[model samples]
Target chain A: MSHDAHVYSKSQTEYEYTRRVRREAMRGQVTTFAIMIFLTLIAFSAVAAGFSEYFIVPILLLLAAIQVVLQLYYFMHMSEKNHGMAAFFLYSGAILGFTLFLTFLTIVWWN
Target chain B: MDFNTKYTPQSWPDHPEQVTLEGKNKFLGFWLFLAGETVLFSSLFATYLALKNKGPSGMEFSTQTLFELPLVFVMTMILLTSSLTSVYAMYHMKNHNFKGMQTWLAITVILGIAFLCLEIYEFNHYVHLGFTYGQSAFSTAFFTLVGTHGLHVAIGLGWIILLLIRNAKRGFSLYNAPKYYTASLYWHFIDVVWVFIFTVVYLMGVVG
Candidate 1:
């Protein structure tokens, strides 16, 4: 290759270092996913078997909320660097979501 | 608290500066994606709760004959396991174990395929029993909520197929690393959605 070409490639390649390293394992996240699924299915089966109606929705609420946290921290990599910035968007979305759901719930249920 | 400590060096590139940009982007981007999913499921949940009993001609379609604990339970297992398999794929991708990554991705794909098949059968049974979408509000919400989830699975399947094919040769480059990671992220997201669906749609409906 020409000297100029080599120079250009060298500069570019400086950033082109090893791409796939060890960080992507994400085992912690995946394992959490597995456990949530297992527990959720157990709950699903139990409810399908017939349960007191009042307990079903509340228990599901707990499970769903917990799973959301797991997805955020684990799958979505929310705990990584720049998490503060990420959390800004995430918390904004969460607050907005809860507000929306609660607003609707109040309008529909309390009314 | 440092992101670097959270993962092994192999989980990322060797030259840390090369990845800082992408990691930051991903951190925000994936959260935005989750926001959108929240709206999607919330809408489905609202619609289902609203129309769960609105049947045509006063016939009042029901799910008693449509859903079975055993089949849904099986599907739940399949999808959940696929999430684990995807994690393994990501793990290998970080390690730069190209062959191992491919193997795990294939496993995830197979599990996803199995789940989709069971879901198809479940929907078929529902339709056969006159509990189809057009039959009642209940069916409409049921199909739309659950069907949306099914559609996500289908999309996920297509995603992995493309990833598997694309990465077959190139292996795990930085370019490809994020692709697989995001796909797995999506897989877990949809699986999380299913946890709700199984509860609110199948379990809650039946128990109620």
Candidate 2:
């Protein structure tokens, strides 16, 4: 309830545990950053290569999707525990957004 | 304001931002707000996709003609790097290193400003080429979708600047940890949106 309510003094075991967690997190961040940069490079190159629209479009979207996931999980820390509510709302919103996209593609644009 | 029992912890082993109750609420509420934003942006994207390239006769410009890849590419890199910088800020926040967090945040803000400036210049270039918002349906949708994103970046820049100034003297406390955390989350969300924009709008336009 208080700011100091949770004790800050950590035993050796707790300190090691925190250290390990942090090390893993740092690794994840570095790896994710590298992959995201690579993905962006691929996306740009795909367009620049002058491939057919059919070939480039799908690949671009797929790369973008992967990059977004990396951004959410690694950068935004959404993959960490205690984020169930956040993940739930995000997925729900994504589904709804997809449906909206479909409606426009199928009905609004066609008409 | 109970100073006696509210000493800053020497270590934050558990949840750093959620050490206090306010952080939990802010974290939850900010996610909900982002959910709404997801839908908000999706609707705009859908509208833009549907209406894109549907301009009336003699007014239609091919996506390749309207977009220049080099400029957009630089802007994308700027925003993406900013996202990574914010992640570093959050890492420092969890470690209870206020100076480290502020340094990374300052870097993030600078990167964000650079991106916004490039976007502005990109828009100006387009207008000079006569791709005004009222020029066509595609133009309108383009501006609305990308402009919405630009507005988010501008707002984020202002938000981070204000936080930096306001918290300069205060440093990191349980009271303000949530504020910084939520702002970083917002910045990451904007980056996520830009990823899609680059893929769907600029890349797709030029390639498709």
The residue-by-residue lDDT of candidate 2 on B100-158, one tens digit each, is 88999999999998998898898898898888989898899999999999999999999
Residue A38 shift from truth in candidate 1, angstroms: 4.8
Model 2, residue B75: distance off in Å is 0.8
In terms of TM-score, the best-performing candidate is 2
TM-score for each predicted model, relative to the true structure: 0.79, 0.94
What's the true lDDT of residue A24 in model 1? 31
lDDT of 2: 0.86
Quantify all predictions' global Cα lDDT against the true fold.
Answer: 0.70, 0.86
lDDT of 1 by residue, B1-208 (tens): 1222233333445422225457446645876886777776776777677666657665746655456777877887787778778777766665557899899989999999999999998888777877766877678778888999999999999999998997688755545566677788788888878877877777776776
Displacement of residue B174 (Cα, Å) in model 2 is: 0.8
Model 2 regions lying over 4 Å from their true place: A1-6, B1-9
Candidate 1 residue pairs in clash (backbone atoms < 3 Å):
A21-B10, A21-B11, A21-B94, A22-B10, A22-B11, A23-B10, A23-B11, A23-B12, A24-B11, A25-B91
Candidate 2: interface RMSD equals 2.5
In model 2, the number of clashes is: 0
lDDT, residue B112, model 2? 90
